[model samples]
Target: MIPVPTGARVWLATGYTDMRRGFPWLALQVQEVLRKGPLSGHLFVFRGRRSDLVKMIWHDGQGACLFTKRLERGRFIWPSVAGEAVTISPAQLSYLLSGIDWRNPARKPASDAGRIAAFTV
Candidate 1:
């Protein structure tokens, strides 16, 4: 996981994004469409049209960093397109990267009762 600063905010861009574009274009999108400064030290996340790919951009004061992730089995969970963007906690970003449902992250039942018992000991 990237080490986000203590007060840094994560912003998710609503709708699909063209993954082909790099950080330069994405930074432009954040400034023009989202109406936020790209270099404001906040993380901006974008999901591709296919929903399997996700890209994130952040300006960490000294430089700009771009990160991307692709899921082999499932798509990344994204918010409905009700607005230009939505802010999520860093913990939710971790869940989103893991291809888990960030909205409702309930624990799943253990696959083996014995395994659970063994770990509890």
Candidate 2:
């Protein structure tokens, strides 16, 4: 999940689905969806019913890029399924997408130069 640009909104789809299955039928027609625009440049995020797998689709001028990730031991930290679309900061999205414990309150201590040097050896 990436942050939508300022003044720009992302239409995130929570349900996991075969994006290809829907893109061909729904990409061109955008009247009923959350954000209506040409599918060529927008970010589309999808998750499985279990919230374990995530897939993203985007078009970067020249071609489309697809990204997918599956967790080995846990599920993706998904937002509450209350609204069709929600605004999120770039930092929150990054943490959620990276499989980090976003809900944890404790922060990991930053490693000092001594620790870094030890690892380099």
Candidate 3:
């Protein structure tokens, strides 16, 4: 579970079960919750009922931060609607935002470093 620093307002939407069953309407959901509430300067998270589509919206005073992620191989595990909010680790968020596979890991070598040998071996 990722702990958002205290004093930062974080709202998680884990209503996937209900959302799926109710045929969640994105426009209506955003309007009713995001538009009406003090969403400004707050972090909002949403997950698709079936797919691995996770959407996040946040207002950082200057502008809104919108984040979305889709897993290419496997579907992300979603929380039960009965739960209050699913906790995500900061590391997980970073990986998800960067389009890196959090499940399967790989790293690329640095390409900017100069060659070690002055002349070709």
The Cα local distance difference test for each model comes to 0.93, 0.57, 0.54
lDDT of 3 by residue, 43-92 (tens): 55677776467776655656555656666766655445544554455565
User: Which 10-residue span in candidate 3 carries the lowest summed lDDT?
Assistant: 17-26
lDDT per residue for candidate 1 within 1-121, as digits (tens), equals 9888999999999999999999999999999999999999999999999999999999999999999999999898899874589999999999999999999998987677547453453
lDDT of 2: 0.57
| Candidate 1 C-alpha error for residue 66, in Å | 0.5
Model 2 regions lying over 4 Å from their true place: 1-11, 16-31, 38-40, 101-106, 109-121
Q: Which portions of model 1 show Cα errors greater than 4 Å? A: 113-121
Per-residue CA lDDT of candidate 2, range 47-67, in tens? 677777777665556765567
Best by lDDT: 1
lDDT at residue 71 of model 3 (Cα atoms): 68
Task: Report the lDDT of model 1 for residue 106.
Answer: 88
Give the C-alpha miss distance for residue 26 in model 2, angstroms.
7.2
Ordering by lDDT: 1, 2, 3
Superposition error at 118 for model 3 (Å): 19
For model 2, name the residue pairs that clash: 16-47
Clashes of 2: 1
TM-score of each: 0.90, 0.61, 0.48
